[model samples]
Target: MYNKRFIIPGLVIFVLFVTFPLWFNAFSTASPVPKPELPPGGEKECVAPASEMRDRHMVLLNEWRDGVLRDGERDVITVGGKQYRKGLQMACMQCHTSKEKFCDTCHDYTSVNPFCWDCHLTPEEAALKKETH
Candidate 1:
């Protein structure tokens, strides 16, 4: 055990370095969970409830995309007395008009880049496209 003291200190230093992030994060106060801006005009209802949509909106969107594109189920759905066509730009964007205010808040906070933008243009983008063309 000639190098016992050096080995022990080195092991302790290595463990501290390895676990520093965990312990530091445990003590540091995290930023508040993002509250995405609600839709304007006091529109409170969605095709589904808020809690369900919050958790599963992506799943619902994927289903809608598949149904519309793959299965050719271009049907309108009625929820809460309002009829909505089965598409993102047709339905969701109608209410959640400002992608920055409504969608970007949560998406940015969660560090996600949803693939929705790959196909569907934002209102700003649409406007720019209109001007260009």
Candidate 2:
């Protein structure tokens, strides 16, 4: 059949396209992402468990954002039966003082550029901007 001529070449091209990323990554020299260091002051834990916070911090933050901005609710969040105020710059940054070392490590690893920085800045970022100008 005339169609027989195209089938072999088409299958070869299809296989190549499907497996390109695996081949390219095997040849590349990319290093693994480093883990974020804990904050100073020996803070023992987050409002939630380390596993929950690592996986779902963004979901928590988004709920906080909606509560604060849209609903005008400035209430404390209860996690692990402990109450913590619900504001990023006010509460979260109290422990996570270094945004670059703490936040950027995970965010960069996942290729996520959170817009939290669009409105908020770490104490260090504010200081740097003041010094630059």
Top of the candidates by TM-score = 1
lDDT of each: 0.88, 0.83
Q: Clash number for every model?
A: 0, 0
Over 1-133, each residue of candidate 2 has an lDDT whose tens digit, in order, gives 5687799899888998999988888999875776887867566767778899989999999998999999999997664455678988777777778888889887887789999989997879878898999
TM-score of 2: 0.74
What is the C-alpha lDDT profile of model 1 across 1-133, one tens digit per residue?
7899899999999999999989998999886677777777567789999999989999999999999999999999886778889998889987888899888888887798999999999878888999999
Worst 10 residues of 2 by lDDT: 76-85
**Cα displacement (Å) at residue 1, model 2:** 8.2
lDDT of 1 at 48: 90
**TM-score versus the correct structure, for each prediction:** 0.77, 0.74
Steric clash pairs (candidate 1): none
Off by over 4 Å in 2: 1-6, 76-85, 130-133
